[model samples]
Target: MTPVPGDNPTPRPAADAPGAPAPGTAQPAAAGGPLRTGRPKPWHVLWLLLLLGWTVSAADRSVTGPVVTWMIDNGVGFMAHADHPHALGGLIGGLFFAGYMLTQFPGGYLGDRYGHRTMVVVSLLWAGLATILTGFLGGLIAFIVVRVATGLGEGAFYSNDRTLITDNTPPKDRSFGMGVCISGLAIGITIATIFTPNFIDFGRSVLSDIEAWRMAFWVLGAATLVVSLAVTWFFRTHLKAATVGKAALHLGAYAVVSLALIMAVYLIGDSTGLSDLWIAVLEVALAVGLVLFVLVRKGEEVGPVLKDRDLFIIYLCNIAILWNLWFFSFWSVSIVAGAAHSSFAASALTAGFNAGAGIIGFPAGGWLSDYGLRRGWGRKEMMLTFTGVQAVLTVAFAWYLSAADHPSLWVMGLLLFFASLFFNALQPVGHALTAELARPDLRGSAFGMQNLIGETGAVLAPAVGGALRDSTGGWTAAVWLDAGLVVVGFVLLAQVRGRRAVSPV
Candidate 1:
């Protein structure tokens, strides 16, 4: 195989080849001369575009967190209404996921079939338009519709970006590249935290407080639009040609597995009352189906589906970490705010968690993963070590939170910061492992499956945490229960096998 300019070096079948590259094997370079030593590759340009797209998508999604309270204060219909704050809040928040989950597979398929750049541009433009419209909407139904639309548009960005990076980047550099892209998520959220308040305040002074929310949305939409245009204009060059024949087989397998899981969940829901245990079991089953689908459909040359010892372990560990992680995202603030004796204290705690996770945790995680990879550590070692550390810290934090004597805000904030650190670090490591385990042709679907599985935590965390809190009249038991899940995840991860040292490029 020969490396061609603007051609993918990863092994796959030729455009006219009889069979696809065997699973797990890198697609072979095109039949041409070796890459010229002096010329710049197109990957650098694509990288910049990816970074821009990721930052914008992340910022668009995260901006809601900081601004939700303000929106409520400013007469945002559903959030401000007294009828059902909890239910309405949950509905508004979950709408994003609802839109997001619906588009995952379609996005992956389109990126594989059409071109990542096209999807990236389309998704960004569509979401940006919807976000701007969200500010202008007058009624609750309108807001929900716009938010859902934004979610649907934004859903494709992450998967498409991952596909772009995987297709263009060299295998040895894949993890680090992924880390760079993932870091954009943190960067966007951090920017929102620091700047959104000021933006809101400015809009209020210039117009009205209610109008400020509108202004924020409009401004965010405009900024995203500009970035998207720039990326599309500069990075619209042709993709490196690479065979993607295996995508069909992988998609077929995923569809079969996904349908089975959905049917099983429906049957279980019908057979049993929506008991807490049944719901939890259903969530776990869905997650397992997703993981198995991705693992099983991986190309044969890459490796056996379940036989790769380390891959399976990494999957379990990731599921555990993500379950706790999602719980923190969805309910931690609500719980802490409810528990704190004072509104001020509760608000502070909520802010601390967001800041810790968004500002500090994400970068720290990426840095640690990159460091471990550079130092010749295999992904399994890095993931397991971090998983254990995260579990211990989480358990200690839960215990502290459970105590009747409340700790000082400063102490609580510190603990929350460390927890976020652990949670954020898990992402890059998990992604690196997934990339390592999957065949190149299946990268997009692989990530889709990972996210789909990880999102099951989203479904479970709220339902389970809500039930526990409702039954116990406190969050103590809920937090402790999450800690136990972490432990279980760690035990499963301990079984994964991989090279002790990083494999050479």
Candidate 2:
């Protein structure tokens, strides 16, 4: 076969050099096992529902990052401090990820053991409550608590969603399915960044001050709840009717534990006259305890996936990638604000431009991945090409932005469009590669583990970016720093050769 010049480099993974078909097509589930063959099932339904859920997930989680700026500008929430705006902003941004970070493994375990339907239902409900409360709880303490809760709720959701998509899709459409499902993030971010300010202003026209922001949360939160129920109904009506009973048991257990933690925190805070520090500690303890409990139950089950060195490399690469992605996602509004000296609307519009690129890029990436596979190309090759090249361009973007003095909104938008186009293309391939490598039963756990490690970037990016800007006096240093991380991530990704090397399945 002639070499495909663009995606396939000569030094390709030796495994795929032979008979491997690109994933999402038919092949052996294991050596000499029954062929895992099915035409793409009615995948549209699952994609739409998951996309709806993910969009809400993205909007709910992303709302705070941009709004943190508004808080700083208005002297609300953590932004009450005039002295450390960057640090405060970073802290606020990081807190959500901190909450998100803790739940990766445990949530994955539950989703794998219990069910994806259960996980999605629980996550959406958790996100809705937290998002709604985040608006109502205006203080710094309340802000952190609720935002962290929102993140925790949102965590593990993607892993489970990925596993489910894999379950539904055949090998051929896998990348496209993932692209379609995950594009929700791009769309949700677009909605939050581009229209949310307008939504807030609309709320203010009816009710002024904090109510505007709060109303934004309220509306999104309510929508999240509605979507959760819709997903529950859809998944229940279709896939996992038997697990419904078991899911109720899981929810009950969660409710009981959550109530106990709430009571413990209240008692400790009230009786001891301890600061909110103790309460925070108790909350953390509860989270850790829950994770430990889940690990104990299925802790041993996660070992095989955990032991895979290549998988670990993939996780680290994901962390590196996310570090930059989240750094940009969480701080782009502010970065634009600073560079263009633009209003929130202008900043959001710039973000919208980047996200808009993602909306197209995500699907295109999947399609391209599939297209390469049909030509007998490899997923790893595509991943290496797309992610590696994008990583370099990201650094260049940072360098160019850092050097600019008062860049125009269009200039910022134009640069971001290309940078984001590459960045978004990486998603489908990375996610598809992950699904292809792991054992079927363990896909959820594998995804959870990778994301668990990966979210470290999410946890740090905001704070790191903020700290860098706070210290260096500009976003250039911060962007450069993240750019370096992405380069390192690409190095890690380079080490992650596919285990099967070539799976036609």
Candidate 3:
């Protein structure tokens, strides 16, 4: 396999060739300690940027929930007078997943085909714009459209994030870098959980009750846009040599995917007035089309390394795990608010308390993974252990919700803390495993496929959870369903045989 852009070292000219430095004369390093190519320090900066990016990404995506809360109360529902707000909330949440779902495979392929930096820049910019737009849109249809656009950009992001991790870190320390950096996802959620309501409250002082949600979007989106531009400048300025080609082919493939999406829209049947069934079918088509588009391409063929049967099982496991992650991330506040009989603002803060658990979990998981790998203890075992703990906590939380008259808010918050602790840890382990299992050439695609599958579940879980709550008028089924997903993921993860650690790429 030809070395991909991010991981590949620059080829040097022959000693006798033109532009070669004289035998004794040495060149100066970049002002910032060293040239970025092949250096570790620049990655520290990039990791910090990733930290920021992940935080903003999580905050941007979580906006759906806080905004939906306001919409439900303030009569900003799907219709002028909408009913079954939970179901509708699910649809809105699912729409973001729908848009997010399609981009995974293509995004990864693009990163593999082009440069990871390019994808990162584009994702941040797109998400920034979409996040801002989501607040401004009033109608459910318009809201869904903007959220999906946001998803598209965000979908591009995760795969590339891992790719950048894979490119920058030596194999031994990959889990550390990926886990610690991607922990920003949790931190962002925490920030949103704690501050989203506050933003709304501040907005209410100056704006209408309904318009308060718009304020959250405006501030978060504006900040994201500024960060995106800064990231773009830093990458472009430092890595000045990157060139773009393959534009024509990339565009052609995109056209094919777009056509497939349109065809799926018609064939899958009309949306039946924004019903869940309609969106599910449409999203499925887009997902299937993306799968085909990615898998069917020439030279894009994956080798046996990627074809490991265990890989798909792991992907399925990730999907199951992500179902838990997304559902909770999207709706935990609502669940807490209902069960604890607390205010939305208060419950959001309580629910977000779990996010703080990640500050420890992420770094610890990465360190543990690296420790295991270095000692030949294997990354999969460590991943499975954390995931198993997550499954148990998931069940415990579900049980408490069902058994207790009013699940103690403190107990619920504590359970959520542990659940998220183990859950967040599982992610970097999975990423490290992917980095280990996948050939460098296929790393981006592997991550894309993993996220694609995971997000498919992520897209549906919120809607399913919400619909279940709407139908049952209780969160028992919804919370238990999350537990069931964890068990399923745990079982699949257990099936993944730990492979011996490979040398750093």
Candidate 4:
């Protein structure tokens, strides 16, 4: 096949080549001075800091599932009188992602127009405040409000964080840095799964049953606030601060619009007694309209990012991935416990194995992608291979859980670990491909568009899984559905023809 104009026709130099600097080796100064060595590069610090940000984000969200499950089990809080406990619990998660999804494109657009550094700090602060409020507010409506607010704040994080890593790291190390940075997600999940129930037990010592779970939110939120301060201080010199402009004001407008739409939907649902599923559909439909308005107004500048057919396929692909992700994230503990017939604590520990695998899987996938790059493999090849393998592993896991009367906890854990290894690894590869597909100036928009469409899966998976579980009277159907989505993602990703490499910005 003929190389496209401006495509890099040759493979990257082998590691032994002088042109290919080893990861962490200093490059010659842009001014052509001696190579600076021994000291850590700026991207290293950013990677560490951003990883912490992801850690906090993951922990905060991960706590919700276990907390809701506890509420249902003990007949306390919102789950006390819930007619459909599973669906209501899933709706809580779905609502958060509804707010989260609405902000994806706007947040990235703001980060692009203003500054990624500033947007990152802002996101952390907003999320922290909203999380703390959730603990303090303590009722059904207030709880929903705070979680949605938290989602709004965190929605900005992905696009900006992706930009920061890609902008700072060299081509060879780019995916690795993304992998390392996002590995915090695994760390945070492990923390939540392993420790959150313990935290609730601690809360039980001093607090009423109704209030005990609030302790988890208070602690996690406080940690997020502390991390925000550290990130602001550490990132001061590492990246440019956001430029203040009229464009920055739009961020607030986006937040207001999202909150209003969510509340409006909830109120309509309450008055008319609409189902949670219908409420979710209304929320997504309105959000889509908002997105279309934003894109049409900004079409001249963002047209390329919006129009790219390959990127659209990737966007659809991510829907399947995130559906698998949040299905597990929001419901994994319950799934594990039901399948294994274990205690809540044991199930959480077992589920942590799945989340924990990403710590290694992310970086390993990134390294392998880079290796494949040097060997002349396309990024599409690396991504699709991982996707297909993950689909198979997911199906195996689903079948094992459904078929076994009492599946071995260890076996279930191993299946989850390997399935997630491939699942998590493909993320950074996909992100790196996104960076390559758009120009530097438009990368934020490209990533924003990718996630904006992709996160619908996050929005739908929890509620749908829950509704299915309620209808089927077992987790078997939900688990199979999750497995099927992974297969769909594999097929969608295979249709992508993009093979653009990241050129020097």
Q: Which candidate is the best by TM-score?
A: 4
Give the Cα lDDT of each candidate: 0.59, 0.71, 0.73, 0.80
At residue 276, what lDDT does model 4 achieve?
Answer: 77
Where does the lowest 10-residue lDDT sum fall in candidate 4? 1-10
Off-target runs (Cα >4 Å) in candidate 3 are 1-40, 77-80, 238-274, 298-300, 303-306, 502-505
Cα lDDT of model 1 by residue, 250-323, tens digit: 33344344434444554466367565435445645655654455456654522442345565466456556656
Model 3 Cα lDDT, one tens digit per residue, 1-505: 2222222233333212223321111221211233447754544666778878888888899878767765665675453365678777876787678777777777777877666667777788878988888777777656766677677778888887887776665556678888888888888888887798888888899888756778888888988998888877666532323332342245235534543563345334434355664565467656766666556664347544346777878888977877887788888888998898898778888898677778778877888888877777778888888988988998999999999996888999999999889888878888888876776666777888888877877778877888888889888999998898888888888888868775432
Q: Give the TM-score of candidate 3.
A: 0.87
Considering only N, C-alpha and C atoms within 3 Å, which residue pairs clash in candidate 2?
A: 24-171, 24-172, 25-171, 25-172, 27-505
Specify the poorest-scoring 10-residue window by lDDT in model 2: 1-10
State TM-scores per candidate.
Answer: 0.73, 0.83, 0.87, 0.91
> What C-alpha RMSD separates each model from the true structure?
6.8, 8.6, 5.8, 6.9
Q: Candidate 2, overall lDDT?
A: 0.71
lDDT of 4 at 148: 90
Evaluated at residue 249, the lDDT of candidate 2 is: 59
Give me the runs in candidate 4 sitting further than 4 Å from their true place. Answer: 1-37, 237-249, 500-505
TM-score of the candidate numbered 4?
A: 0.91
Q: Cα deviation in Å at residue 194, candidate 1?
A: 4.6
